[model samples]
Target: MFFFLSSLPELFVTVNRQPRGRICFSFLWVEGGRRGPCNPTAFAMEQLSTANTRFALDLFHTLNEKNPTGNIFISPISISSALAMVFLGTRGTTAAQVSKAFYFNTVEEIHSRFQSLNADINKRGAPYILKLANRLYGEKTYNFLPEFLASTQKMYGAELTSVDFQHASEDARKVINEWVKGQTEGKIPELLVTGVVDNMTKLVLVNAIYFKGNWQEKFMKEATADASFRLNKKDTKTVKMMYQKKKFPYGYIQDLKCRVLELPYQGEELSMVILLPDDIEDESTGLKKMEEQLTLEKLHEWTKRENLALIEVNVHLPRFKLEESYNLNSHLAHLGVEDLFNSKADLSGMSGARDLFISKIVHKSFVEVNEEGTEAAAATAGIATFCMLMPEENFRADHPFIFFIRHNPSTNILFLGRLSSP
Candidate 1:
């Protein structure tokens, strides 16, 4: 219900479902953190952000290979947070692979920094509404370690609830799914399907986060019209192209020939940065050039404070909504988290026995962009021939492009995906 999760130094209860507005998804299921200062450097939250970005890109590359011509979306932080809850109960190679995959050096950095940053983000009355939650549902008969339970509860604000996973699998699934749906504002309807948990299910880990914010500068409806989007060199589709002409932060990468533009959310607390590549002979492969040069370092360099200049830009972005789910089993195994799912695993920290291991990882996320947040604002586009007055740039996403939503204050990426067909 209305729990005042860890924000003000006065409290330390796990995340509260601070329900507010419209939806953007972040729900996770893991069949699978400590404490330190609130430092934001390579030692603390910054490292976690770095790890999150690194894993985000890695996962993006994997998803791209799997669905080369489809739109993909995910919340790495949501997945990582859910995994962190499970990380509390991991040992040996299980923890090693997780550490390596996330790029965190040690247990201290992962849990301590995660705890610090989580508190900073969960600050109450924030400009935008954000709800992140995690819970552990274990079979009432299962025997988990007291230390693991206490650590997760204190550091991650997660609580382990007793559920009849052995006898009432469907009921347990519904309860977990309902919690996820509520936390995600219904953007994610269900997190656990019929076959995910059953009589032998001993534990289920879940996490969900929701975010909704209005644009600092509105894209007027009158400026929007049906425009042809080049899905690739061959296919094309009609899309609602939202338009806006405003002075915003913009950058360009000479090597990749991609333009980066930041469309800030209301109050400028968060911004959506778009990476639109210049149309080449093979328009379909334009994004590949950008992706080839894409890295956490390059991304930071391209969007850094000094690299971007505020200029008047004519923005033509397609109105799009994306809801995606991933079964991350094969993906993680390929990423070096091998032992977590198979018989050669070790999760003894959970119960002083190696009997427990993760069976699957399910991730779901959703997002929608339009004229504004929930209401439409009107603006007229400026038209002029010669740039003798003022130079202007054009950011036309009539084709595929990559985008990321960043929490400005922390510089932590909230969401990352590409609109290939939108």
Candidate 2:
């Protein structure tokens, strides 16, 4: 019943619904220039899936703890793809650390899964527009190996382009930003700032995702009204609240003490799952507690078919929008991704010589939720910087809460956000 927006640029800023149901783990692969069905039940696939979920949960806890009082929004997929590209060039412990931190299996496995997932999501042919794009802008003089470029094009669908970063860095930045803007439908205009790319810059890896979807059971525009949103026990602000009452997939996690509601988009291939805490007096406390117990297993169990009961519920969700930007260098270092950013980094896979290292990873996100649907955009520029759920019944998101837009088939969390003020 609302719009969601997200974006991630160095200092850049910018810019779903359904029902029925969908299952997960069935993917499609392209081989011999033909598409074929592939099951996500293999050992490697399971390992990657579990690892990615765990990584998402771990990163979420960090973000939740880092910005306890403010709103937060991030595109893990975009960040992951950006880093995955860098990981392809890493060796020894550098690659191992990234693989461990991000829950990627082998480099081969990582690219293949992303390839299949990207293809499946984009080809759903549903009433939604979802796009994930990647680009690599390296210094025109850098000798990038052919093998690296081939792997990127085959697995990640990314083409490495030569950009003159040694001189005219600003122009290079502008070109990259323009490409990002075009990929994201102008939702994210400025991804890299003036100083983000300088003479010392070697390679810049970028990833962008844009999604727009309509609700299966759209909220009536006439039902929106000005309502008091509880910022905290002692503070309040007026917000435009959207109302909808209908049968929805709903669950209450007793252990976490929160309500979980799943609002499906038109095609039922994706959904926005909201976790509204039980107590609104102190919004931060409930969210903090949930973070303590949040895990991949718990998320899966809580949203399982048996746990969510169909019920006629009254929903009061605010018509809110958020645009957030983050510099993830320190945050990622704290998450065991240290080697890639420092001089000791080994990124020889991109070039035959080990002369490349990540300088910074800048991200920005935007989300808008309204009576119609959700619109979200996120851009991540590795300026060589490298960088969940619930169900329903009487969900009243009048205070701070956490939300995510997920691909139901792959169980991939595309965009995650926190609504603090709105």
Candidate 3:
């Protein structure tokens, strides 16, 4: 049965409502090569390119496990580029040495090499990464590294020193901001408002994820009518509910006591599937069951079967906005990246040792849903950019609905978020 499930057409979706495709931009510099002078910057760039691809795949699995109903966007360019600057600062390492340490004939080679290692890291570090990803992707997330550092220091009760979060260059800040805007579809504001650029802060790393989609059987706008929504335990508010009546790729499993719907993207490379509990009144149980049963691998297996058929569905999703921020220093430190945070650590590749230490890591995200479709964005500048778009649909999220933005070709998730209330 599972084997049959794997035969269904795959789909990929994005936030911009366009055809799904893979696009990447990168810059490299190799300093002080044995033949002559290798561009250290090039070596650092290569490292970022390699590391980010690995990170993206790992992140996809982590997010897929937690919330399989949404889109995901990741900016390897921003994260790798910023990390490259930090890599330059590492001590006892020449461009040639660094290049040799992370050997690769092509960018794809680097990705393949680190892919498995990143997966291991994700498995062990799921909680930390998910918390960080969610907070960083939240709307109103900070833009400066120092602010992020300070916040993180306080959160983790880490001791602060004078050497932390110096400053970044204007050029670096601009580049980071551009990546942020690009990833967020111009929704995030004031990414680098002020005091965000300086020389001491030479690099920034960022990653953004998002997910949204329409119903397999879309609700007609005419059917959409104002409905009262309950918030928390008490607050009741009126909201629009989109109604639809059509056959959908759906399933009702007694084991899980829920109904499932699959929403396909433009290329059929990915789909945003939703699992609603039988007891809609008890949202927690539904959410919990969905979380337990929905794994990335399982979804891939289930969607492969052709048993799914059209069924009637009345969809109601509320418009919602959630903003969160994170300080990644502690998170990275927890991930065994403590050396980079210490002044004693070598970073001569970027500049002289004792001259650099990570100053900050900031992230922000936003989302909006209307009768037409869904729009969302996320930004990380210290620095990062992750953006995606897919075909338009009649997916009016009037009631609580789950969605996922995914890549059909790679089965990679770029972003994942949920809209429970307007």
Which numbered prediction scores highest in lDDT against the true structure?
Answer: 2
- Over 331-417, each residue of candidate 3 has an lDDT whose tens digit, in order, gives 334433554443444444322334444444443344444554444443011111111211212333333434544433333333344
Tens-place lDDT digits, model 1, residues 183-267? 6566555555566566666666555556777888889999999999988888889999999999998877665667789898877
Worst 10 residues of 2 by lDDT: 22-31
- Candidate 1 accuracy as TM-score: 0.85
Instruction: Give each model's whole-structure lDDT.
Output: 0.64, 0.66, 0.36
Error at 102, model 3, angstroms: 16
- The residue pairs found clashing in candidate 1 are 14-157, 33-111
Using lDDT as the measure, what is the rank order of every candidate, best first? Answer: 2, 1, 3
| Every model's TM-score | 0.85, 0.85, 0.51
Clashes per prediction? 2, 45, 89
Report the CA-based lDDT of candidate 1 relative to the real structure. 0.64
Q: Which residue runs does candidate 3 get wrong by more than 4 Å?
A: 1-108, 112-185, 204-219, 230-236, 280-286, 292-307, 310-312, 321-324, 331-337, 344-355, 379-402
